[model samples]
Target chain A: MNASTLWIFLPILTGALLLFLRNQRWVAFVAGGLSFLLALTAWLLPIETTLALGSYAFKLSSTFEILGRRLILTTNEQPILTLIYGAAAFWFIASPSVDKAHRLAPLGLVQVGVLVAALAVEPFLYAALLIEVAVLLTTPLLLSGRDKPGRGLLRFITFQTLAMPFILFTGWLLRGIEADPGASALIRQAAILLATGFVFLLAVFPFHTWIPLLSEETSPYLTGFVLWVFPTSALLFATGFVDRYAWIRTAPQLPQILSTVGALMVAGGGLMAAFQNNLGRIMGYAVILETGFSLLTLSLLKTQGIDLFFLLFVPRLLALALWALCLDILRQNAASLSLQDVRGLARPWPFASVGLIFAHLSMAGLPALAGFPIRLAILEDLATVSLSVAAWAFIGSVGLLAAAVRTIAILVAAPAELAWEARESWPQRLFIILGGLALFGLGAFPQWVLPLLNRLPAIFEHLGG
Target chain B: MLLNWLAGVLILMAGIGLFVSRDWRWNLGAMALQYLAAFWLVHASWPLAASAVKLITGWMACAALGMTLASARTEPGKEHGWRDGGFFRLLAAVLAGLVAFILATRLSAWLGIAPPIAWGSLTLMAVGLLLIGITTQPLRVILGLLTLLAGFEITYAAIESSELVTAAQSVITLGLALTGAYLLVAAKEETPQ
Candidate 1:
């Protein structure tokens, strides 16, 4: 079988199988590990090159076609696939700790398969439909056997569905632009539609209210997975558009618009996170800030911008995973994640509290954490363009830092009589410890992964780095 | 031409019926009529088989939702006697439909779309938006979403008539129906009997 079929179809088939074995936790672990191995094989195995195993020799092609459409997973996409499946494995392995092994493992695998399909689909417009399907899949996960689906889930579905028509319409209009490159009216219309669609998809500014609500209402682990997968895939999809169309990437106003939107998301999300009393909402704001940073990177000199964009990927994933794990652990003890509810939780769950603090601090771009190096790089780049913009971005970081400090204070405010104790299971403690180390390792030795990150821009031929 | 106009009238009636009615049974009937009208409209662009599939899947969706609602021991808000700001909502829906019709006419004129297709699609979209915006009920919102998708599909079929697109649209319709059913059941479970 081709790599596309192996990577995409295998996980999908596994996910389907998982649905039947939902009650068995071991199935989730085995299936999740096997899916990760498949993704890794796709990443490492060279396509169109023969491999010999004892007396057999075979080559795995990169392209797979079904129903007149094509899915191609070129070598350049290996890094991205590796990242996606790696994160999936991390989340899946940790699912049992959050009491979501059954639902998240099965459905999450399918969600990843469809999202990867979104990126690989030929004609790309079909990606819009695929994205809607993925969003539909997420509804069940978000509801999670609750008696009633929350308004947040409804809003999430509504906003995501609304983006589909705009994107599909944009694709239709783009044909007009392709036919007449000099047709200013058509180009303008396409641009507006495309930007509006991404705005909704990325949840920029006014469209982002659902982020905090969903994060607050759903399990932190599930919310983290959704937040990570949706925006990352959407950003990658948007990048594909910029890479494919010269007019879109070369639009003089494009960089300015991206920067403006990015700045707003950063400022708005950061400031809101600073005052938030709920830990889940804080995670939500952190995601918004990260998205804002990613957008701002797009405004940089194309090559540098694209490179910096990929740089944010691993750090953000690590920080979010750590944060969600801590939240889930604390949730086992506290009735709610509100500041009032989790106050003095540090006494009973010291490691988890530390993980929470560090994760938040990392997202806030504290020095010696995963998010700091990338945030610094982006800020430096922004300074070259506009120092005022850089200053504003820095202020946003400070807002998040302030929130982290407040959280730390609350966690440490236990009575003198209270004694510290390790409440987390061994596996949970191991995940948290490993996540914390990853944050520090990536921060301290970013060069180790810089080579891989630098290759990310190569996925887009015209987007030089 | 006469059949096209008839299809348009059926679509308009369905949109208006969905707006004015509160009972699930009546809404289901309106939805079925809307899908049938959609089949007729889509027949102009797609194959007869494709159009038939649309109608069948839509009816299937309606059946799934109908069964879910029927199985519930209580109807949504049965005690209130349809006291869900019915008059204002209907008035708002009518106004929205009128505005949407005017906009669709202008849009079609600009895009050079045929009148029947544009009118039916825009009317459905406007009414769907009205329902989704005004109602907090999951069933109503889901119906609105399905209506919106129906409208989008009409316009989309004019541009791309691929079987794949049709199949995808059918999946979206069924998916929305299943989600609506899930939400309806969940709501039922939540209610203290």
Candidate 2:
């Protein structure tokens, strides 16, 4: 059996079947268990190699072909598969308690499965197509079919659709450039096309309006999952482009451009996040801020960057999941997530309040939490290149810190007569506490993730080298 | 040669009609005709079977969307006079078409494609974007998106012609329409009892 079929097709087929099961709890267990099993298999089984269980032996192939195109997931990519599916399991396992509609498990599974294909698909440009498919899959999940569609959702779909043509055209242009080396015009056009495509896909700076908008317009859990999955795949695809193309990798200004753009995104998302009143919008801006940091780490890949990029993922995902869960819980109990609406919410829901505060502070890179070490390391690397880049990134972090403080103060602002109580259900509290603890645990010992992260960059041959 | 010019004319008309009209039926019809013309133009380069799929897929998209809007509760598209930004929009659209005309020749030469193909692609794509930029309505945005993508596919088909890529683009087209149908029903103020 091909690993692609195991990792990609199997989950998609299962998700489709789960769609009809009609029981939310059953959907959660079946999907989550399957996701966890897939992650474990990817972690333990070496692809394209024979393995024996007692007297039985088998080999799982790394590549599969469909429609004359190849999907290959080598042993080097097993860690990434494990991480992606593990994250899927994280979201799915929590669905029964959080999602009443039963949509997240089945559709989320399908989207996750498709995103894995985006990472594994050969000729990498086809990844754009797969990403589009995933984005479309997410549209239905964004709405419960009872409410008016928000303009943010509409803009989100339009902008994502715009990206595919630019990327696909870049593929054709790149081939042209390859055939006619020294055709600088073709090379330049290709660069513009590829950059524009990514700008749209990554929701970079100016194109990022939809992030905060979508978060505020939809359920926090679904929007949070969309934010986490889409950009992670896009960034990896981008690194593929950089590693595969000599022109892009060899460009002396490439790192500078990346750092500058990264710094701007951090500054933009951070400064904007500081002023937002809605809890969901704050989560959105925080995501944008971390995505900026990811790019900063990405620019340094040839030096100490690739490892830093992968290291950023676990903490980032953990913080987002926790923050989203807290907001979701608050959303359920409160009138709205606005500052005034959720004020003094800590009186009844201390764990959720603490989870919310920790997740925000963790993303802000406060000392002793998950986001700090990688943030510090990236700044040091950026300073070596240019202090202004580091300064801009620092300023962005400070903005987020300010926002986190404001949130904490508001969450605790209650009258003395109010009594403290843990109103969160046991399952909700367990997920929130575990997520919060993972943030603290990962932050205090950064090396715990290094073994897995160290294996990830090899997925990009040139960058890893 | 005359037939190619006729195809180009039809593509331009379909794009402009969709760009200006508020009526969903008019938009879908123009888009449907636009896809047929696109197929005719691409037939100059691609296999008859491959290009024909574009026409079929595009029509199926129209049918899907048409059926949804047929059953869904939607307000009648009100006609606007010059006082309601209608004149300004008409003027703006002509300017957009002019820009496409000027750029179409250079794009044709640069990409080594036929002039008629370039003309149709740029016009449809530009007007599609204009449609998106102008309206907040779900149906309009999806129609605009379809036109924009149809333009892109025309140029892309001429360049790559890989059946897989073509099929993938078709899937996205149908997906967008189906998704649009969902959005329309969801956007309705009251669900049927």
Candidate 3:
């Protein structure tokens, strides 16, 4: 079997099997362990090399074809696959602790498979359809058990679906632009259409309203997973566009536009996050700011920018997973996530509250945290581009920092008689502590992740390399 | 060509009907008519089998949504109604449809699209978007989504007539219908007897 089957199809098949399993805890452990193994194999297995097992040599090819379309997982994409599946494992393993493993694990695995397909599908435009399918799959997960689908879910699907036509139409227009490179007007039109499509997909600026709202309405863990997977894939897809089109890559205004939008997202998200009373909304805003940081990173002219972009990935994933897990854990203890509801939760759920604070702080790019190195690199890059842009980005980080401080203050605020205790289960505490240590470890030693990130830019020949 | 024009007219009428009416029966009837009209128009571009699939799936979606709405409460206030600001909404939809028609005409002409399909597609999309924008009612929003998808499919059919695209579109239509049904049931559960 090819790597595509092993990494993409196998997980999906496993997920399907998981649906029949009656025990939720078993589903969580199986899904988590399976995903972790897949991620390990993807990361460690060398493509185009034959391995001898008990005198039987087997080779896993990178390309798999279906109905004349190709799902190609080139050696360059190994890091990405590793990231996706690894993050899935992290989320799934923590899911049983929150009582959401059954529904989220099975569907989450399927969603990852489809998202991987979105990245690997040939003709590329077909990815739009695949993304729509993923979006639909997520609907049940988002709205499950709720009396009615929230406005957040509706808007989420609506906006996401709306992007499909724009992307498909852009693909159609691109054919014309490719036919005649000198067709400047057509090129301009295609650029506008393509930018608009990515804008919607990336939820840049005004389109980003759904993020905070969905975070407020949905389960934080599920929202975090959806938020993480979709935007990562969308960013990669956008990179694909820049890689494929010479005109787009060379367009004079493109970098400036990306930087402007990125700056706006960071500032806007950060500013909004500071005033939020809800932990979920704060997480939502942090995601928005991170997306903004990614856009800014992509806007950088040098390969270092691409390196920094990939550099941000591991930490962001870890931080978000930790944040979401903490929120979910606290949610079990408190009736609501608002400041008033969760006030003094730290006295009972010390680990959860601390995890929440640290995760938020790490996401804010605080010193000696996983997010710090990359955020600093991005700001440095922006400094060369425009000092004001750098300042705005910094301001955004400060906003998140303020929110984190507020969270800590609110969580720690209680009567002097209140006693500190670890209310979370042993497993939950272990994961939280490990996750926290990972944040500090990655922040302290950036070299470990740098090699993996360095190889990511190699995937995009023209845009990054 | 005459049949195509007739299909366009039916689509336009149904598009308007979806926006103007709040009654589930009327909305479902209009949605089915819109899909039927869409099949007729799409048939001009796609294979007979593909067009039939679109028609069947669209009808199934309508049936699914209709059945769900029927089983739930059908009282005037239980679902969305044309009670307050109905005239204003209707007026807004008409104005949006007009603007969309004009813009689509210009766009299609510039892009060398056939007029009949373009008009139908633009009208449906405009009306659907207006409905989605104005209403919070799950059923109405869902119908509007269906209308918009119908318009998108018509436009896409003119450009690409692949079976894969058609199949995907069918699945999306059905998915939308199921989601609408899910929402309706959820709403029913939420409403206290």
Query: Best lDDT goes to which candidate?
Result: 2
Q: TM-score of candidate 1's chain B against its reference?
A: 0.90
What tens digits encode model 3's per-residue C-alpha lDDT throughout B1-193?
8887788788877877777776678788888999898888778778888788888999999999988877876654333445666677677767766776678778678667667778778888888888778767777777878888888888888788666677778888898899888888877864321
Interface RMSD of 3: 1.7
Question: Interface Cα RMSD for candidate 1?
Answer: 1.4
- Tens digits of lDDT, candidate 1, A1-465: 587787788888888888888464685686679767965775678777899999999988888877777888887777778778888998888888768788788889999998988878888888988898899898787775554777777878888888998899898888888898999988888989888888889998788988999988888888899999999999988888988999988988888888888898898889999999999999999899999998899888553747888889989999998998899888778999999999999989988999988899999999999998989989989998978778878888998999999898888888899998888888788888999998899889888787667667777778853
lDDT of 3 at B82: 58
Which structure is stronger by lDDT: 1 or 2? 2
Candidate 3 residue pairs in backbone clash? none
lDDT of 3 by residue, A196-230 (tens): 87888888878888898898887888898889988
lDDT of 1 by residue, B27-121 (tens): 88999999999888888888899889889999999999989888886554342333656667667767866777778777778667777888888
**Model 1 CA deviation exceeding 4 Å by range:** B76-84, B190-193
Badly placed stretches (over 4 Å) of model 2 are: A53-56, B73-75, B190-193
Considering the two chains of model 2, state its CAPRI-style docking category.
medium
Colliding residue pairs in candidate 2 = A300-A305, A301-A306
* DockQ-based class of model 1: medium
Between candidates 1 and 3, which one is better according to TM-score?
1
lDDT of 2 by residue, A125-182 (tens): 8888888888888878888888788888998999999999999999999998889978
